[model samples]
Target: MRQRVQIEGRQLEVSNLDKVLFPEVGFTKAQVIDYYVRIAPVLLPHVAQRPVTFTRWPSGVDGQAFFEKNSARHAPEWVRSVTVPSPGSSRGRETLDMVLLSAVPDLAWSANLAALEVHVPQWQVDGAGVAQLPDLLVLDLDPGPGTGVVECAEVAHRLRDQLVADGLDPVVKTSGSKGLQVYAPIECADREHPSRYAKALAQELTRQTPEEVVWRMEKALRPGKVLVDWSQNNTAKTTVAPYSLRARPLATVSTPLRWAEVDALRGGADPESVRFRTDDVLTRVAEHGDLFDVADRTRAVLPAV
Candidate 1:
């Protein structure tokens, strides 16, 4: 059943208020909408002007799931789509017209479709309709078999030092799953492309700490080590945005972390300390504000590849 509701003075038809989307936590579809609505102020800036690939769970997460990139025909006039050349595609240069999520209402609308996960590339579409070069370099750390976020945290400390050595300020975050994502924000225009520098940095790190980290996806190389997935730096990829909810059984949110919090994990703090859920994220935003404030839109430039 569809019901009209007012969100920031915009009338939206929100349905399935009582539907349990996260059965483990008894979280409902309405709660998901509320979470997005509340987190939009911080969430929108990271996603604004960027094309988004949405993970939709129409029948709750367990029933059915699909990823959607195109804007719906019934989408509001304020909502728009942009077609861009696929990055590094070999199949005759494919193009994808992705939904440009520019407004808070867009979040609510997608939440209505049970789109719980929002993924955005590092680059954003400018007013000129050109895809700007990525200002952020992300290093994805995936733990190997028998290892978990603890190994990720240990690897993250090493990565943080290396990133700092390279003169890039590192911001850390939980991937809302089992890994950690470290992002270094830098100036993009008129500088070297981020992919070159990102790949180089990742490669250098692997060389510097072969035992602690590996860059390859080979499962054998991953055992007892954290995989520094540098491939995510490509123009086509996206890390889970901070504060976005994950469809995991615990309904965890990808959360930003202070360097101190990252260090605290070594002091016996639970990795779950940083694992935020929808409600916990709201309270956190109210109390501490966006943990990503340090890494967003940084004007610092990378020294050289």
Candidate 2:
């Protein structure tokens, strides 16, 4: 049921590799591991030194699923892990230890769990065991019924414009679902908080385009608008790390999009213009390199509150 895979010099246990994950596409566990192996060059940078959360589908994507936060029990001893206080664990006194994926073996082993979706917090843990400040602020743009990625694309453009005006460079990506997420790297000594700044920006952006953007999470307000989920920037919150494969029936990936692609969609491009699958993503990296390299940008500072 399980096999030891030797990659480079490290070894990993890959099990249930023939099991189908995406029934419609016949995607299997083997493919999942391969995807991670191929995407590691681009993904490791984003996930390195950050705590990881796993959404496991042991049987398959259509089967029952569970989330795993602590990986030490299942992870190899060589894997790097850190424990941080749970979101509000009695005022942060309690803590939970988790694996930090920094290499190919870490990812391949995680793939064995059918972890189709991987999420990570914005903060990185320092060797001193402190959770450092968030370097990236993410805004999740989720579409409601009657709207599509097209609408989300438009909203993303407007959001990007607003962020640029604020002196920050933001990158847009398909959520690998029917939504989009924008990641902006912010660095400013004047503001040490991420949640407050992200929330204020989302609310302000909603005010500028009330008809198409909804900052509140109320369902009734989402019909024709993209929900600007600023809450993802909270310290305890997590967003799907870039290059993560979404647990979709279609085996889609949370792909980084060049601003031109988003602009094209808003200008009448087809829906698949931004949608990418495993093969498509590998090819993309081969040609364009890592498009999300801006995620490490530290030059643009957030405006003081």
Candidate 3:
């Protein structure tokens, strides 16, 4: 099934509206497009200025999925994009032309392709289309065996305290899968500072609680502890954008949270309470706006490490 729709003065022809993308919850391609369309007001700001790498699930979550970074080939001419240096390009291309989903129509177009996940770097592009210094620092709290969202919340609180002490205001969000991510707005002079600061902070946390936290990614060392994944702060790496839907069995979203919610989770709230789906997130934005807005508006320098 396909339909023609007008969004933000652009015409988009979306297909497979009845195709099931999340069989567990009966979510269809239409629902996916609708979610992105309705959530565009809040979702576009954080992603508009940066190049996006979409994770496409054309055959649904139960089937094969792939990441699409160079999208200029098939993107509509009306859809804007940016060209940025790609140092790790295996294709031998010096730069990648990535999609910039700056408008509601862009979201609809991507969703029509079954792109369930949207990922972007911490930095935005300058006026001349060059990559700028990272504007935020992130720490992915990945729980190992015997630990889960509750454990991640506990670590997030600790990270919040340390980030606060370092003069940076931090926020927390669910990873939309199995963990949590802590992000703090930052002002840095170069590209490497966010990654360095995140690594140093994770090391400090590990030092303070080696029994509960592990900074390294070794699978053997992860049992019963949360891994502070500081590597996502790298300029070349991308974190899942807040409010973007995860390609999980239940259509969970990488929803942002208030500090109070994090406190409640650590205070014994059910882990399922933090797993928000498409409708739940729409309701949240209606009531609370974007909880992750601070990450876009506030900036504090990364204290010398």
Clash totals for all candidate models: 0, 0, 0
TM-score of 2: 0.94
lDDT of 1 at 77: 62
**Per-residue lDDT of model 1, residues 255-299, tens digit only:** 888888878886778877877787777887888888787545455
- lDDT on C-alpha atoms for all candidate structures: 0.80, 0.85, 0.91
Model 3 over residues 78-128: C-alpha lDDT tens digits?
A: 988888887484378888888888899999999999999999999998867
What would the TM-scores of all predictions be?
A: 0.91, 0.94, 0.97
Model 2 Cα lDDT, one tens digit per residue, 57-94: 88787899887786667888878888788776235447
Number of the top-ranking candidate, with TM-score as the measure: 3
- C-alpha RMSD of each candidate structure in angstroms: 2.3, 2.0, 1.2
CA-RMSD of model 1: 2.3
lDDT order, best first, reads 3, 2, 1
Candidate 2: where is the Cα deviation over 4 Å? 89-93, 188-192, 295-298
Q: Considering summed lDDT, which 10 consecutive residues are worst modelled in model 1?
A: 86-95
* Collision pairs in model 1: none
